[model samples]
Target: MKGKLAAAMRNLGLCVALAGLTACASGPMDVSGTTPGPLSIASEGSFFIGGHDVHSDTLSTVPNYATSGTVTVGQVYVSYQVPTHARPLSLTLIHGCCLTGKTWETTPDGRMGWDEYFVRHGFPTYVIDQADRGRSATDIETINAVKEGKAPVTALPALFAASHEAAWAIFRFGPQYPQRFPGEQFPLDSQSGLWQQMVPDWIASLPTPNPTVPALSQLAAKLRNTVLISHSQAGIYPFQAAALSPNGIAAIVALEPAECPSATGDLTPYTKIPILVLFGDYIDQSPRWAPRLNACRAFADAAVRAGGHVQLVLLPDVGIHGNTHMMMQDRNSLDVANWVLHWIDTHVTAAAS
Candidate 1:
């Protein structure tokens, strides 16, 4: 078929483009919101930040278990890719509760995720696993000690894992499981992919604001001109980071945040940096989400009153519909990403000058 032949030719072209990484590093980027182009990657690597080592209760002589009676925990892991001639601002993405950096990765239908999308658009991209999640290691000694009766049962860290049934409601798929909102964009058939991303969240044990907040500040300082993009439970980190240290932070993009910085808190931290609070559809019908939306609205209003650059947008108002909490993994994820990219270009880059 003609379509199949065209597809094969385009695939061949992409391979050719990828092979030209260093040679065409400054090639024109694709901002048209279609399949990205100039697939050149100049550098790609990962690192860990924040956290500290804790003394382990049991010291073992086993080769793999050997340590100086200390184990490293609470460090946040970051994977970064810098395209040749990357834009001035770098994007740092953090995931929600029960998720990892994987939230910004390939969609359930195997479509391109935001990480690769931004890189193709000529911006350095960094994906983070919040402290104690995924590649960001956590302390197991407390759990081990509790099980061994060496530590009191109260010492067991509070870990919360969402059931698929609960996620149905939490993610706003519908009033409950086995149901979906009308015109929903989430890929129903590939739900197993979503479940695969859900992990045990041990946030209750972590310090308030989470170690990732300070680590995010450190990363922002390192990356310089960084735009933080967070979702769900991890949403408040950027605001906290900005308060902790506003240097090097260019902007904040929060997607369906669980909570916003209190309206009563010092609003001076956000006075310069642009902030966007985005939400998907059906919040009016969601008992939990409605209140959250109201709270975010209040914070945005307060931030604006405090002379901060804050704006709130509901997807439906912008004609993007049927998105659940995990908008990055939705069927039209690239469209969503393109919109956010446009915001960065307009607000951060333009405002800088």
Candidate 2:
């Protein structure tokens, strides 16, 4: 007993087994004969450059404020993690609208999220809060301009938040909270906590060359061959970023994307990079998601025709059901994550072969 306690202290890690017994250093060890990492953050910082250099003479009669040229537009925050024995591949998780990198952290149900899960499974992980969302800073001036009708915006409409009912329907959570589909995998008991995560929506900055594209592209360029896992409103970001810098992305896993690139657009950038589009159950029931699915299918078809490798996975077809758009927070979220891990492994193997 003394020796076991000593070892536990040495490893300084604990795992709860199925038998409900606490074990220390009882699992697979790394090449160094140590337990796998516990998702330590390797680095974290914001990618920002919305400020003009303040240029003014040291001695100016005019007020320094007037002479100074300083204005900050925005910044995107990124958090990175690496396992003790990480695989060669890396993953970047991009959250959807009304969410942040927190979406990949602990779920409302108190389960470890994909960020930690992937790291434990040997993949370096990067979680991003896109510019103007979450931890990333936003430009109040730009937003106020749109709100005050001072900006000539061509594409995006005014941003707004959804009521609980509206969000329920939008998320395809059975038209109402606590009234989920039969055999629903979501933890309905935790609905209150989950609902608390809902944040006000940011303006859709699609037209006028959205700044997010360039910021995301810059992030991709900074990382070495990354696999993007984007969800919902963030689905098309990977495509755009990859198109901007084809060499950066190794692959993409888009979950219930709100949009996809046009089938008519050039897909040359995606030819070498593989893509997997995953859809959950209850999609057919949502009037909103039907067209999105069709668009994604068309995009996949176009990608395939362009000599790109793309696969679409439907949860129900694989015997997994009762999933909603927020599958990451569902009771079967671990199962879904396992499937994604398997897909990533397969891709890695294919690349090696």
Candidate 3:
């Protein structure tokens, strides 16, 4: 009788197998369970040497050969969560001038950054610390040489450093520090963190055929049809990468790019790729930025005339206000991200679907 009852319960799926024992199952069991994690991390770190040399030093206590090299370093760190459902695109975030990938990792005010948000929302986001910045490493000797009015002995590029006060006005946080626009979105209390993002930038390293372009292009190629999101000085990077590989980048979202393809530069390469240029508030009011913004407009206009798909979005015209150049770190950053996501959904994913 006991054996018959046990068999009957097993047939009805009420038994849980255990060591030398069987217990009654508790309600319905989850047959298809999800894994806790084996979260994968893909990281790249390296110094790409431009030149190498040996030097002799006589004042050494121990006999050691002195060696130096002209090199630029690159670090691309990425963590991705596959979308709950399939999506057709990924994102490669490039930081602007003087900043590193950490800029997108967290806001100055300690809010969740765009990188984690996008990854959580299903986009496989890749963040890069461009050559000679952030975790990648920099050539300080090169920087000091430039400061001392010395030209580089090798053909290697030079990096230029900017002042914090200048960045204050230039970023349009305000004309100067401690004097911000009324109701500005940037977190004034965390201004020091923002300043920490500033690093020396390589001159002549972002245009097409430059070493930096190829370095970033390689990353894009690995991503297979990624969308590039660039800010400030990095704005030229996507254009150069896309122009070089043409088919590597699926689209581009440039946030207040400091550089634009010259009006005379070829736009034919970008004709098929969708591009969006976003400008924060106070652009027109900024004497330092107004002229640059004008040039950007001309480039966008010219691109459109040449059959490129381009849209220049001004935040103020769209009802957002008091945003500095660092809108991603602004209070309403998520709102701006939503706009960008919508663009990606409509232009890239929708079309791919």
Candidate 4:
């Protein structure tokens, strides 16, 4: 029976063995073995890469702010340039799954990349290294705890593990359902797969910081303007975070972001903030692309209905191919950055007026 069950899952395009199931599985894969030093504050300047002044900054101190009773689960790697100008905005850049924050740098072609473009335009930009990715610490002890049953299987890490398992099950069981194993309806069967159902519960199980209230408080305290730029899968973080604190964020730029499944809740909270969504025409390559794009459309419509600003820009002649989700690496990435900067400038001006 067990063998038959396993065989059934195999036909479903699901992997029985969970990939990256280590204690370090929650974030991006860090195979570089380089440990970054403590964060610090620094000045704005240009770093030479390929014979050009690509705006860059050294690691500075982490911003000192009151924790919103949530343990900081991840170490955010901030590469920012504090530009000297009036009403300068600070941007937090979030990367997609399996990628590090370095993906935001300019390409070899000398076009201004996301980070460089923002910095050169006088916007301070910070990239977060989500927990278990890049230089961030992995919660190995937590994994061991859950596996040993010392912790609830429903704990955040455990939930995440289960979610991955569910994905694997679907992938493995999906293909066999109609052939090798017929008429067996696995509870995890769906095009969205099992991960969609599990992510929200996983996110809820994890420690959530009241980034909205505290981020707003921090902005108020510093009297600085702020915006969030999220790419690919990481897009969900800021969108949900902003939804949690809509009034705190000035604007949001979602670059080929993965959409939050509706089961998460009404994301209506974010509809009140200005949002500029940049989607690649090639988004359909991934299995999740259509669902994600649909989710983005719904969110965009909601934002517009709330009397908030929203713009959807589709990349011309682009499609799901190599590096489709990595807009920062695309040849036309600089063009997208330029448009984003202009959008920000225009919106800020409109807000002020």
Candidate 5:
């Protein structure tokens, strides 16, 4: 009877585990209600690359470029427009957690957008859908390996995706840390523990590669003269990957990325590269946004201290409507995009001279 009871308990546990897995597998909702408007490029004239016009108005003609077979988990979908006449400047934009590559484009309202901005400027823009989010395979076993003390198979990518600042805080602070919650001294560590427990199975389910070094080396080879543009939680991957590269990246544009744990090691490798950070002050109005902004500030400070060329743009008080985290979809996003393009142009010129 005892053996039978044990067997029943095991089955029950398995059922619960499967249910939890199913929950985590669910992706984010499509918040984009209306298609964005036509992209407007500020280039001197029309240019062509890979048979596509860099400043085309027709969105349907935009080529869907795939960067696959290089990474193990997902087929990276890149929407590209290469300028035929100009030297190709690659801008890879990485989305935040739960959000897809579509988040970088126009919203359902059709008022705000990004596609036209890059294409118009003669820059080839590529937006990435991180593994397990969009068309990427989710390896539950791999995640489990990390929680079990086994080194994860994919180093930089996994670290960026799975490692949250809140989790690291819990590991450092313990239970009483929450007594200071939401204010200065508030227990960020406690929140991290809560997030970990909330998604423990998902954390434990990630894969660990038998040989991480070679995997990273292969990833580096896949990326050439690329400028990494990351948003929110997704910042971890670009930062980590750029650090691993010998020449590093051309530049990085981080839009309100989550904070990095102190344990994550030095980010000084990217010191020579330009790092542009765009933060939304109004994000703090929502309870969900406060922690993320705090984390972003912390990470920005660290990157600057490490000698990275850091530029922090704090959004002004534009009233209740301004706090949205999806600033890329805002009409004013053009200002930010122009700034980024100018920076890239300057960098490219400097490299040539």
Candidate 6:
């Protein structure tokens, strides 16, 4: 009976599998080669998951239909592509605080993004817009209330929108706006493209840990044997998700996370998975990022001592340098992505074999 119940639960989780007919084709990526082979995809689609209805007080003066419950907030948007020859593990890419899943779509200078590269490499790639961010719907009940005078000024949600100047320091583009760290791999000529991707972050209004963390856990079950690849603000979600539900999570690749799980936190979930925590260059220079790197190293050490499979890779140590906080979008983005793919093949796939 217990086994049957588990099977039913798994089936229920997978019921939301890719609802796609969007065509895709790419041969496995060859970073070293001059060209990539033709691509082929068996399925590709997009869908939303894990949202709760946020019914606002029926206020007058708004559009007639909107005066009714108004919105379904917190549901996450996911788009996926499954290759013709899929691998044993699928990948789910999560964007950071201000950006959307478009982070993985293309480089600012118009290079192939990691999403396509991974999909072409035979891992079904899934990318998500976190709850109340990016393509995900926002909870505008408060916005409606304020405009209608139904709520006080103080009742307004504090939304955070990052300016390009602030993003310069935050994303490690340079010491300041309009400056460049020598050899910085960020494509400076197309920086306006990066700013275009920024949007207002609704983190202040969303629940702690956000709906996206739980949604990630659910996605793991749906994708089955998945690797959760996260960056910057999303660095911790995969760990948090794995903590909640370890089943179906095969590995984790965290790229320059804002913070790593505490070295003292419960680490049982990590013992069962292969984990990679990677950081880019310029840590010692920036007081902000240096601590984060230290924290991850401490966490990695603790996880390793506890018999968990964890590796913390510093980019410069591997001879790849000049990466900023946004390493995945750097000039050497594909180089970084290819290195990760190689790591997956070596650690995850080879171990499974």
- Compared with the true structure, all predictions reach lDDT values of 0.84, 0.71, 0.69, 0.49, 0.47, 0.83
Q: Over the full model, what C-alpha lDDT does candidate 2 score relative to the true structure?
A: 0.71
Give candidate 2 misplaced runs (Cα > 4 Å): 1-69, 142-157, 176-178, 205-207, 349-353
lDDT string, candidate 4, 227-280, tens digits: 877776566666666655554467778887766425335646665667788776
Steric collisions counted per model: 0, 0, 1, 19, 26, 5
Backbone clash pairs in model 1 (N, Cα, C under 3 Å; residues 3+ apart or in different chains), count: 0
> Which of 2 and 6 is the better model by lDDT?
6
Q: Judging by lDDT against the true structure, name the best candidate.
A: 1
- Candidate order by TM-score, highest to lowest? 1, 6, 2, 3, 4, 5
What tens-digit string does per-residue lDDT give for candidate 1 at 1-353?
Answer: 44344333342333234442433222344434446443567799999998887788644434686534877888999999997656778899999999999998888778888898888776789999999999998777777676667789998899999999999888988879978989878887999999988999999998876899999999999987889999999889999999999988999999999989888888899888999999998999889899999999999999999998899999999999998888998887877887887788788963333
For 1-353, candidate 2 gives per-residue lDDT tens digits of: 54455344333344434343354564333322124333434444444522223332221223443422454444567788775545678888988878778888877878778787777665778888776676665544444444546555652345767677877777777856536677767777787766787776664643344556666777766776688899998899888888888766778999999998888888887677889999999777778998899899998998898888988888898888888888888878867887887888787442232
Q: What C-alpha lDDT, on a 0 to 100 scale, does residue 328 get in candidate 5?
A: 66
Per-residue CA lDDT of model 6 for 1-353, tens digit only, reads 44344333332232222335232222334433434444567789999988877667733455655576555778999999997756778888999979999999978878778898887767889999999887788777777678878888888888889999989988887888878888999988998888898888988788887899999998898877888999998999999999999977889999999979999999888888999999888888777888999999999999999999999999999989999988878989888988898888888863244
Q: What is the lDDT of candidate 4?
A: 0.49
lDDT digits (tens) for residues 1-353 of candidate 5: 44334333332232233332332111111213343223333232221111111221221222583312222332244445553323445666777654566666654344335654565344556555454444443433333444445545563233333344443232222223333222122123334322432221121233332122222223334545567777766655566665567452567777766643332467666566777766654454435556755666666677678775666566553221232345565434555565566667775443232
What TM-score do all the candidates reach, one by one? 0.88, 0.79, 0.74, 0.56, 0.53, 0.88
TM-score, cand. 1 vs. native = 0.88
Candidate 5: what lDDT?
0.47
What's the lDDT for candidate 1? 0.84
lDDT of 6: 0.83
For model 3 the TM-score comes to 0.74
**How much is the lDDT of residue 30 in candidate 5?**
23
List residue ranges in candidate 4 displaced over 4 A.
1-75, 106-112, 143-223, 260-268, 284-286, 317-323, 350-353
For model 5, the superposed segments whose C-alpha errors exceed 4 Å read 1-75, 139-205, 208-223, 246-248, 261-264, 284-292, 317-323, 346-353
